[model samples]
Target chain A: MSLLRILFVVLVAYPVVLIMLGINVRHRARLPRRGPAVIAANHNSHLDTLALLTLFPLHRIAQVRPVAAADYFLANRLIAWFSLNVIGIIPIRRKRERDGDDPLVACYAALERGEILLIFPEGSRGEPERMAQLKFGISFVAERYPRVPIVPVFMHGLGKSMPRGEWLPVPYFCDVFVGLPLKWRGDRESFMGELEQSFHKLKEKLAAPEYL
Target chain B: MTRLSLPPQVMYALLGAVALLIIASAVVLALARIRPERDYTELKLRIKTWWLIIIVFCLAIAFHRDVSLVVFAFVSFLAFKEYLSLIPTRRADHRVLFWAYLAIPVQYYWVGIEWYGMFIIFIPVFAFLYLPMKMVLIGETQGFLRAASTLHWGLMTTVFCLSHMAYLLALPDDRNPAGGGDALLFYLVFLTQINDVAQYVWGKSFGRHKATPTVSPNKTIEGLIGGVATTTLLAVALAPWLTPLTRIESVAAGVLIGMGGFIGDVTMSALKRDIGVKDSGTLLPGHGGILDRLDSLTYTAPLFFHFVYYLHY
Candidate 1:
């Protein structure tokens, strides 16, 4: 099957059928899931990815490309089925030495089509207390499709539940935060740094609003 | 036997007085935070205002007897005005808005004449054409973009849409006369409002998580389910006494209204969120405004009324 079509069946169809069966689904943001959208979030837990998998009901936004680590979902069928079919995982090879790997090129192409792409630019999961600096992937994708708004998301306390494979996540309700959409200017380095700070600010906002 | 006495007409006279008292008391309860001094004065003014409304309402009930639709038409007019005031429109499209105003009567006129075909087409097709032509006549030259949008919204908000409230005035079914046309009005109104109230109640009581926290924080699964459950039960019980519906039929009809009402409420809510406002206006105290009351009605009125008209009528 084609890469794009396979991704559609996975990201859009699977979770919808799950929701109809009553899987305790909830959508957090007030924003419209339509038009050019960027779902960028903190890369803490696997739930940061799974939560988005169930967000859309309308079939128009079928292809959701998750920027995934090559180390995690590279060769396993369970992960591969999730990546290719349900979640539409776009594998990012971070070796920096591997030739002909072009994951960023794939992401840019998806963005141009006005597809929903989930990117976590903390590079990798950080220590529990602190938010890691964001990678340039968000800015890179934003630059490619400047019309789309990069929406910042924060998933709290997800990493505490089975971080890096204990088989099952302990069930406890934690707040999910989706901030307002941010428009990207031409500057890449500054935008990346801003996005990093943006994610941290979201966490602070979730814990307790600074204004209050 | 009670009819033999002259007290019924007197009792009917007291119906207006009773309605006034209930409304005044309800408003007092809703604005429970008002200070005692302001409260008494507000209550007095409220009674006076409701006295006018209640007199008009009771007078229509007493005199015309079959003019419930006319009362609803007035309600629709108020609702349309509230909606038009809130929604932004281009100033160049005055002719379109004028035609939209013209549509209010034309649609109700169809109900008056019982011309279902013309009534249905009057807004969506005819108004659609007439509006653009009106815009083009002025020949602003550069304002076409704004002109087109304003004209369409005016029709949607004012004319093509609101006429359903008038259509509902014709709701007294052949099967039951006791309920009268006002029963349909009561059904549409209560169903819409209770759905909103029920959602809030359910959300507050059992809401473990947010459904659309960013767009609407109050919406939750617990609320949606609870509201539907409560409204469904209420609809089943109320529909039989109020309309020509049976126990099962009432359940089915209520389910339709409950779900349809929710969609209409959410759609209006999303629109408000997009515009970043709470209530449409303060036209009606404790209810926000006329548009706030009418949002669900706008979609619900036509929906249930048409459903009853085609299948049940």
Candidate 2:
């Protein structure tokens, strides 16, 4: 097992699993229990990290790596070890700054390995309800690995569960909805355009009164 | 002058929390009763969130007076968060932006530890090097120039600028416990807000010529001069009660805050013009989001902090 996968189970995924059940976890989309899939989420809170994990039985999976920023989580040796190896996070350098080449390469490597990669299409995390401009990185990777199914994931009630800077996660019962896996038809631009629309469609699905 | 020998902080933030919450909640309730709530849920949520933050700040200060500085740091973090969320940022610069985000807490940490020498320039000089280096490393030949500049601008506007006020509490003074930081906070905040109100009222009531028509149409020279004069006179009278500054020094402080505040407002107005928004957020009942409340402080905090640091620290 990759060090990143172990860290994910022990540190991130465990707490999420415990909390999801604690909050009476339910899946409206009713995703399959097992699969090699790529889950993309809305960008908004730091807690959005664990919020997505609440939907997956992460421990059962052997190869899953969530893409995180190299600057924040892996800026130092200790945090890097925890984020990159233990938590099963692939540190990709954000192309915006002058320093993100290594992480982008790592992301490509993880996809080639057939890992259950978590891609944040909107890039920076925070507002799961709104879809802003998304980086084509998810599409870029998917274009290379056509077999990997890209799943549109959205979490309701996360904005209140843990806002920015509040260390303690509030006892708000948030729900997660994973849409059907979106299969790419091989054209990179068309796939990305469709994926962006899929993200909004899932958000609209979660935003309905039934999910609340 | 008598100085009280208490802990590092008196930790009266709980008192402040209660006062602010009642005030904020009352405003929200009154607004909801008078206006349609459904049309403005977004505004209500923002205020509620601000109220929650204030409550958390109070609890943190009351519990750990020694680390009450964290509360101010947290405020800066929120203000920065709100500011960045509205501003457009590209993915190519995410690595350095992360550094910029982390810089919020670290900048406030320096204020908590009272490290002025580096805290003063952490964003401008060091962050300048760090942001460029991060961008350079990405090796993306295109958009580096624009992205790098925006990243630098965000850090300067948000963290470096906002952290100055929190640093004021660390001012080396012989007057009171907490080094009169609370007084400095009240004094500056009160002055900035009053100046804003006074300018708006004066502009609305009187005057002919616009201050800058393009940058800020609501601003008028008559309003600026009248507000500054009125705010300066008020500071002269209020200084002895709220801050340790002398009456003359208080007048100077008032003038500084008044003028600095106008500049900050116009600067934000310019950005808003670019982004095309009338208010930063519809959070406060009559007020806007954290950005609206903080816009003046972005310019005033650093200007005022540096003033006291030179004359009073």
lDDT of 1 at B275: 50
Q: Using alpha carbons, what is the TM-score of model 1?
A: 0.48
Distance from true location, Cα of B232 in model 1, Å: 1.1
Model 2 CA lDDT for position B279: 67
- Give the per-residue lDDT of model 2 (tens digit) for B1-313: 1234323333343355357557767877777788863455644664565565455544443434345566666566556655554455444554555667677777777777777888988888888888788878877657778677866776787678877766766666465333366566656766776687678768877867999899888889999998999889888876765566777888888899999999998988898777666666521112235676678889988888878767765
Q: Can you give the DockQ of every candidate in the order shown?
A: 0.01, 0.05
True contacts kept of 1: 0.00
- Using TM-score, give the best candidate's number: 2
Per-residue lDDT of model 2, residues A1-212, tens digit only = 56456566667656653432222333435454554567787765666666555555656455656788777887788877767555667777776555533336676666566566778887775443345688878877777678767877766555444444544443323446567777879788888788777766766643222111
What is candidate 1's lDDT per residue for B1-313, written digit by digit as tens? 1122222323443454466468757777666655544545434544444455456545434444236446545665555644544444443444455566567766777877767789888878887787778778877657676556744664675455656656655544444453545565556655766676678768877998877677667778788878878888988866765666667777777777777767766776776665556655321122225565556656777777776666566
- For each candidate in turn, the interface RMSD (Å) is 22.5, 11.9
Candidate 1: stretches off by over 4 Å: A1-212, B1-70, B141-146, B171-173, B282-288
Query: Against the true structure, what is model 2's DockQ?
Result: 0.05
